[model samples]
Target: MTGLAAASLAVSIAVAGAGVPAQAAETRRAPATATAQVFAVDWVSLGIAVAGYLFSGGGGGGGLQAAIAEIKAAIEQSKTEIIAQIDAIAAAEVEACLEAHTIEFLNIDFMDEYTLRAWAQNATSCATQASAFAGAVQSPQAVDKIGFVIGPIFAIVLAARAQAGFINGTDLVLQSQIRAYEAVVTKLTPTDCQLIVTSEGSAFYEKWWRCTAYNGDVGRSSPCFGRNCLPNRAMAETQATLNTSRPVANGALPRLRAALP
Candidate 1:
């Protein structure tokens, strides 16, 4: 018999044994002898056997349904747990990216007071010129107000754009994790699921460590060793090579936006 058929038969027999009602008559029967064959068969024994078969069939069906329900519940729980972990990871990744970008900005002299003031003045001059050009087509006072707003707004936009780049990088890493997690879920095997989760965790740690190492290389190679020095220069060249090697995906922005709260 097939495995499923055998399992069904076993369940039926077990249920029959458990639910059998007591009977007064000797229900056990043997193959009839030529003399005994002439006598009539017992109708009561036939009824009992039919009843047992029906009861066993019903119990087996119930058992199969219970098994199915259990499997479904397990899958649902696993999905929920995996998604929760992904969300937490995504949040942490965003925070890390912001922190990294902040540090990168701090390292750049343009983020310092003197350089910042110079940039602000340059941005203000550009805004004033653009406004004057637009004034020919709109209200002069309105254009002047717009220019006034643009000075500070432009600085804010620059800072925001810098932050966005880091956030975008974080989104790429999160997308990788999501894809890996989905692959595990699709396989729906215990071992594959465990491996995927473990691999994702390892990847996260490795990326963070690599970023930290890059920062350290930047620090060691700065000022005393001078610009375009060994390690920092090499690191920049290596990153540029990696960027070229990877395929660019334009749709990543929308994916990252959806992940946001």
Candidate 2:
């Protein structure tokens, strides 16, 4: 028994001994003192009860150990459950990011401006969700083992966004080049030239030849040709985006797989 328990037991025994003698003296003093004797007996009983409690586990013995062990086990189980749930959530997010954005971004080189723009919007939405998830996991306090899993996923989303920006930029450039070409062609074409109805349609062929020659010259000097071509630049941008995001996606895959069941 602990020192406190031993001390309590000794005090209870002393109280019991003193109470018995007092009860005997009180009974001898007066018949009316029977109540007093009973009160003394009650005190003795109370002391015995307190002593019994102390001797058992009230003083922090085996019962306390058992209770503490049970509490610890419950806490550990709760922690494990919480961690598993977080791991599952992280795995799902990583997979979604990969499927909706990362894989599609890899095919950017093959997508047209319209297709690329559509994909960009989708990637942007995915990135928004990824950013929110990343913030939730890190804020208030960072969760253990989550940063490793989420960091690469977030990076790949950002890369997708960057690739999306390139798509928009290239589209603008292509549009501008088209407008410039149309303006030049409108200025060069003879506005008042009338086709003459002739034998074997010679006047019609002559007009067609002149227009074709002018258009060919414009085409050779247009932004659509050579290294300044928007299509080539767009392709280069797409490849660059793929290069930047590939490592992040590759690195995240292993971590995401590990986090899953």
- Which model scores highest in TM-score? 2
Residues 1-261 of candidate 2: C-alpha lDDT, one tens digit per residue: 243222322211111222122122211221122122221211112122222333343444553333323322322323333233234444486435534453454465578878876776665555445434444442211221232223322333323333334323322322222232222222333222222222333332211111122112211111232222232232222222221111222323333232222
Instruction: List clashing residue pairs in candidate 1.
Output: none
Candidate 1 residues 1-261, lDDT tens each? Answer: 122322322111011121121121111111122111111122112212222222233233444333323322322323332222223322343323322332333333336665555543443334233333323323322222222122122222233222222222223333332332222222211111100111233233111101111112211111212222223332222222121101011112233234422
Model 1 regions more than 4 Å off: 1-110, 137-261
- Worst 10-residue lDDT window for candidate 1 reads 189-198
Clash totals for all candidate models: 0, 0
Clashing pairs in 2: none
Predicted structure 1, TM vs. truth? 0.15
